[model samples]
Target: MTHTLVQDEAAIRALFTSLVEGMRERSPARVVARYADDAVTFTLAPPLLNAGLDARDPEAVAGWMAGFDGPITIEHRDLSVAVSGDLAFVHGLRRLAAVPVGYPEGFSMWTRITVGLARRDGQWLITHEHQSVPFYMDGSFLAATDLEP
Candidate 1:
């Protein structure tokens, strides 16, 4: 592998790890810091499409974290990252587990995530993020939340 490829891979890996850590800390600001100022996202929540920097507002993250009583843990598996020049993308399965404050002691979710990054100057910043779960296509548009990766 080329030196640039290795460095790019490491940079993307660090960004991914930082996202997990930020989520665990329940700090949306920290998580959003990995993105570019004009970043866009397709989140798993309702109104899935989020555009512009406001899309990464800490409030959105806070709303999601509010459901969990205990600390939440996030893990990504089967990750694959590719970089070419100043652009890169990463895709993987993400697992999020937590105990809702008012719900069952154990609750978990599995979803797919893809991130697009752009190298500006000497830094790599996420420009796009898409996260989603499959849904039933037979009449009912029910999300497959019970499934595991």
Candidate 2:
């Protein structure tokens, strides 16, 4: 049982690592491999909205990734992951690069991201994600905006 748990954890970690790499490489196909067939993704970009997709559907995943010109770079830290049965959750900080010229400043904003994941068919996959920016004003972390719920 202990060995099985360890292996499970290792597998989940690998799945997440691969997803991160895929995002950096702008490979939606690779990223989609880490999601379940009916997984949903919610993005908080201005004009906040929710979008749903099927992970097993490669065409849909590829189409969504096509919206971006290239992969977005990310640096993750303080990552914590836990798995129970077929469910897992990961919370961490991510520094993302801004979109190129003519995009809004928000597009260039670097922010922190939190994500939820699940395991199916003995494989780990991302099921949901939430991202936020740490508001800073005059070099100090603005408690009100930065810590707003």
- Compared with the true structure, what per-residue lDDT tens digits does model 2 show for residues 1-149? 23366777788778767867987777777877776655555544433534455434567546555655555665666778777777777777766553543454434344566777776665677777777765556687662332311
Question: Each prediction's TM-score against the native?
Answer: 0.89, 0.65
* RMSD of each candidate relative to the true structure: 2.3, 5.4
Q: Scored by Cα lDDT, where does model 1 land? A: 0.86
| Per-residue error (Å), model 1, residue 71 | 1.0
Clashes of each: 0, 1
Question: Clashing residue pairs, candidate 2?
Answer: 34-125
Q: Which stretches of candidate 2 lie over 4 Å from their true place?
A: 1-3, 54-71, 98-110, 136-149
After superposition, candidate 1 runs with Cα above 4 Å error: 1-3
Q: Write the per-residue lDDT of candidate 1 for residues 33-107, one digit (tens) a residue.
A: 888878888887768678775667778788888978878899999889999998998999999888888886786
lDDT of 2 at 8: 72
For model 1, give the 10-residue run with minimal summed lDDT: 48-57
